[model samples]
Target: MQLSLSDKFHSEMARLCPAPLPSVLAIMVSGGSDSLALMMLAHDWAAEMRQDPDNGPVTLIAITVDHGLRPESAAEAEGVAKIAHDLGVDHVTLQWKWDGVGNLQAAARAARYSLVQEWRRRKRPEIGAILVGHTRDDQAETFLMRLSRGSGVEGLSAMKALPLSHKAADAAGAAPVIRPILWASRADLRAALQARGMGWVDDPSNDNEDYLRVRTRKAMRDLAKIGLDVDTLTRTADHMARASVALWARAADVARDVVTEPYPGILRFDLTRLERIEEETQLRLLAHGVGCLTQAPYRPRLSSLEALAEAAYAGRGATLQGVQSFVQDDALILVRELRAVADYECPADGASAWDGRWRIKGRRLGEAVIRPLGAQSLAALELPKGLPKTAFQSYPALWAGQALVAVPYLAREGLCAPQYDPSAEFHRSILSH
Candidate 1:
């Protein structure tokens, strides 16, 4: 006989928490079977504990994140909210929307957590835990996915039941995140929901073959046909998680030894110190340092990491996607911006040509020749004829044909006008430069 929904929830809670009931808990429900089952269990558990005099009434808040990737996403969010309301729980739906280029999954996850953190700050400043529904099957799938991608120990470790807090100290306070359902299998969650007569919406994207996760899931099914035990896979993931934690600790220590924050969004490393570390340690430390500085999960490709290592050891400069690291004055500076000198020089007086590369010629104050530089000029200029010299100088240079025909400085209203002080410092600076 299958366990009842309430029994299943109580058992899971006992296994995960094993302590006095928390005063408040937040459930992340996506209207999917896994999350909905978790929410139902939490609601039942909270109700049972309400009779105890020592435990106060549990504040259960259901949070749903809408990725907005599909047309039905808004409707799904509404459904989740209605379910939470029916269950006598408060609900919040966070929409992920932004206007820049970013990894879709990572960006959505960031936005979702941001909304959760905001809600925690406003309503439950002293929340005991924020619960997520990640099942053993999901853990197995994650491990297989990472394995196929040639991932390191960290990636192979997959998700953790109790992930460390990534929030700022001010925002997180003392609340901890918990995952009671990580030990539960997907089949068990489904069985619990069936016993409760609860239903959940199936996400259509789960079946889409175009996504890497879908592909990995398919591969996992094929492997299962060959008698791969799902439980064993989960066990392997747990083992890998332990190893990953150890490796990360060492990497953090190495990073702390070499990487120093001299300013906001900048890290400085001692090249000599880095050289003394093992090559693999050096690479991991460098990547970790960059990740912390950018607050970006910057997983540099193997080739890119190798290149950076070579550059660091050779005392050369190398540019990564959003960072540049180079040895300057015996210090390795990992900078986000690198200043480059402008190659072309500005022109002087009437018509001066410097290097066949560019030409700068000035015409009569009132009758200056303006032309565009190329098929695509730097800027388009429009000037009024017979303007004051100062006003002319304020006018922007206009692009005409293939030349910069009219510059504001030489215009009738410009500061360089013949009627004005022709020997003005501005003119002299322009000429000298």
Candidate 2:
């Protein structure tokens, strides 16, 4: 069968990626029509480039992620692997182990990326990029979803052809995700597959009414009643995506100026400077900055951002989504872990505990002990016979010669449980720089 569109797509891929084709390129093939079509296109591109004198050959690896929501998911994965083998492409199946905790979709997404990133790190650390097969229809769906959720320009812009960078450096390393078929439509991809006589597995969940995508897709079909076409939606999404890029670039510039990293996992911002920026810009900058710190793409609620901005302006404290911001002296501290001080059991002498950058020493002293104390300290003078469960839970205890003295700086409460005078030698040892 003649595949004109597939051949054209393969040519486009060559023009986009250029030379030095990565040693190993991963194709996220879910055995669906779109992804399967993408795999075939990529395979053809690799073969053509290998034959060309200008571009060298590249290896293609097909990755199928099994969400395991259905009983046939494992079998589906096997089928995908078989197809990959038939196409002479390496295949790997990443099985999802859902713990049944948080949002199933969100968790599954995270898990999928984690597995792909880990595999790249271990096997092909030098690989330049991973390819995903998100079409124009997918982009339109994303744009509509964000619009329905009251998203800003960035949200509405949806997925990019390039891989999104990690918000924070602590997150997975920087590897660009390349989407080769972003410009292609679902119908076009389906036609390409049909033209090539390629078959794909149909995912039942895609049609299930319970999913937000399914519902939105149904609504989109209904939109056709009003003479709205999928092509129009796709074009609008494309325009919005460009606008989002410009807006995000501006926001990033503002964020770079106001946000500072004084400590690990801690962000500090100048409220006075923030207040001078325009209201919309301020909101966008704050959202972008916080999202960067959290390495999460989903922006916090508008209400949360407003409250945070208000707190920064008023020199108050505000907590949202496990992140806390408080005004301290002249600067605003954005703390990731901001919990009330609690008691902890101290470890014995000649031991240590690591708390971020600090290494705390624990040493028992007959008459004097050195330790860091924050808010939670023993009200009495003498040490209790046994440590309270609360105190023990707060700090990991260390023992030295049958005596407990210091705890990690993070366990400030427990370290000060049996308080000694500041002049004590043991106290000096634990607190010494």
Candidate 3:
């Protein structure tokens, strides 16, 4: 049976945003048909919920990111804003300009999400979820792209509606994001907009064959002639996602037996036990350790991870993905490379994270700052056991200008103490993804 838009949307919302709904929800509107339909459907769903006396008024905010890539972007953003206002939802627009740093499309995507996260943090901390308009089409396209790259289980698994993507930058208090429309097809979305007598801006870049996505989109029809349709790709992605979850759970369990944290940021593994694990589990565990240390959302390259694992098995030491792994004393030690964090610094405001892993907190000296416990800082101090001196160089220390105040992990008589640990994150990340 064909369900009404209200029915379909309400069902998706119930699945994505469970009861006692968030007070504020952010809907990403890019002025495209998919996003426009998402905004309209969200409004209808919110209205349906509000009709029940038991429900409180939910704030629906439409946010448009003006990437400034097209000349029509500003006008399109305003058009979205007008529509949002008509739906009785508050609207805000985020602005971005290419600094010519990297790939324009990739950079634009990362910047868009980062901007929205920052906005939620500073402007609306109450926002419970940021909703995006990724559809079945996006999932299929991403699957093909990853397939071309020879991506394995995790990468091929594609996107999930819940739990903000790990590829996304980590935000402390930001709302969890939901792609509630992933089950919706782009054609269906445009149909909904057409039924409403509404229009959407079509960015010319979508037709530009210079981009890989456009090329992929064009190839979909040819592949479909051979029975490799969107449904086939999406189903394959779903299967991979299911397999991925099981694999992650297995890795988490194995990690408990083989991994330990002698210090906050450092990961130590039982070399003998690690060598006995299945190849898949070994790679998953090593990836988790390196990911936690580097705080990188994406896993290290497959070749690099495999090479490092081979080296560790032979009792050799090498660095990859900002983590230095060496076999020592019957253990495989993974610590942050000293060179990776040499110039890393943040104000000692007690809130700044050092190396994106540890938080160091203590007394506030004049103009205090948090930086690595380099050789110069460790020169006069008595060191601690359980870790090499080179490893300590990347550990955090508090300094007031030139005077050293404390080393959080080392020489902590009256100095500051370690406030965070990456191994905890390693264990937690497996479940969330």
Candidate 4:
């Protein structure tokens, strides 16, 4: 008995989401075959949930981002909205509205995600995860592109089913970005859409050889004549992804043993212990530590990270990715590079993060600027004992004019203190091994 496409999709969704599904699941629809198919399948899934008495009501929201780069973008968004209306699913269109001459693809992607995040924050905060239609074909294309760029295992692994976005870190949100159809092929999705009598817009940019992805896609077609087809490449990516996960688990163990944050925005690792670990594990730990401090979406370049790791292993000081590492008393202290620290102005109400390192909070921070504790700023204070003066400059403090209003880490009186969000390594318990 061959199962229907809808049945296969439902099974995949069950494997991805399982029990206790989110109250709301957002589908990212761009009027493309994959996205439209996802919207239809998501609606069907919601309908199935409604029929179950034990399951609570689940809302399906479709989000479309109009980059406004092309003339037909608005029309495409409207098309998606029409489909959503027909399916009885809530739909919202967001505009990226920007004028710039740069990498259009990267800019549009960032803008799209930013708009989606804003919508989630304001309109549907209950959205547990945002689903994108990234099929195995997309994964194969990504792997081929990354392989051409000389990427390592992590990059060659393509995309994960559930990826953690650092963009959500600043927003203080834990909503993961998921691609439930990563295991499904693009042809399968298009066939499913065809069966449902659905039409999709083929973006002109997809065939533009000016883009690397398009050239790679064309190259992949020829490569398919040989044994290197999309399925084979995607399977290779799956293997690489599994290896990457295992590496991450090992790195987590290494991080637990050697790394510790004595204070906010400061990381200390036992240099002696780190030097003894495998080189690959050392690199992963160092990259993870830097990403934790900066809350960056991606890790630093492998070449740069390797150089930094070598420096750390030799007990020599080095700086990279807005973090400075120096050996101090048998421990490598990685702190926010003061020269690179950006000044963060305090918001009127609610806490604001400073330099992606510290979250500053206070009632009397009206007209005050939050920055690192500097030599001049520290001179004015009576000073606290047993505090590492070298690392003091990286501590976040509140300033009003020339007066140091607060140095929270030092337990300065009547000042606001910043708290560290351990959400970066929040999965340490499971990965600690």
lDDT of 1 by residue, 1-433 (tens): 9876567667767665545666778888899999998898888888887876766778898999888888999999999999899999889887776656776656776777777877787877766678988888888887887787887766777575553333322212435567777778888788878877888888887898877778877788778877666787888888887876676666566766676655323456778888887776677766664443333433676668789878877888777755667676556766442221112233334343222112334444344333312213322334333221121221223333334554433333242222211111111111110
Q: Give me the overall lDDT of model 1.
A: 0.63
- The numbered model that scores best in lDDT is 3
TM of each candidate vs. truth: 0.65, 0.73, 0.93, 0.88
Q: 196, model 4: CA deviation in Å?
A: 1.8
For all candidates, what are the clash counts?
A: 25, 8, 0, 0
Give the alpha carbon lDDT tens digit for every residue of 1-433 in model 3.
9997668878888877767777789999999998899999999888888886767778899999999988889999999999999999999999999999989999999999989989998988888889999999999999998898999999999698874333343525456778988888899889989989999988899999999999999999999999889999999999999999999988888988899878777788898898898998999888888888887768898888899888988989999988888788878889888899888888766677777666666664646788777877777877766656666777788877777778765665365655674333666566665
Lowest lDDT sum, 10 consecutive residues, model 2, at 424-433
The order by descending lDDT is 3, 4, 2, 1
Of candidates 3 and 1, the better by TM-score: 3
Off by over 4 Å in 4: 163-171, 313-316, 347-351, 360-369, 379-390, 413-417, 424-433
Which pairs clash (backbone N, Cα, C closer than 3 Å) in model 3?
none
Report each candidate's C-alpha RMSD, comma-separated, in the order given: 16.5, 10.3, 2.5, 3.3
**Cα error, candidate 3, residue 179 (Å):** 0.8
Of 1 and 4, the candidate ahead on TM-score is 4
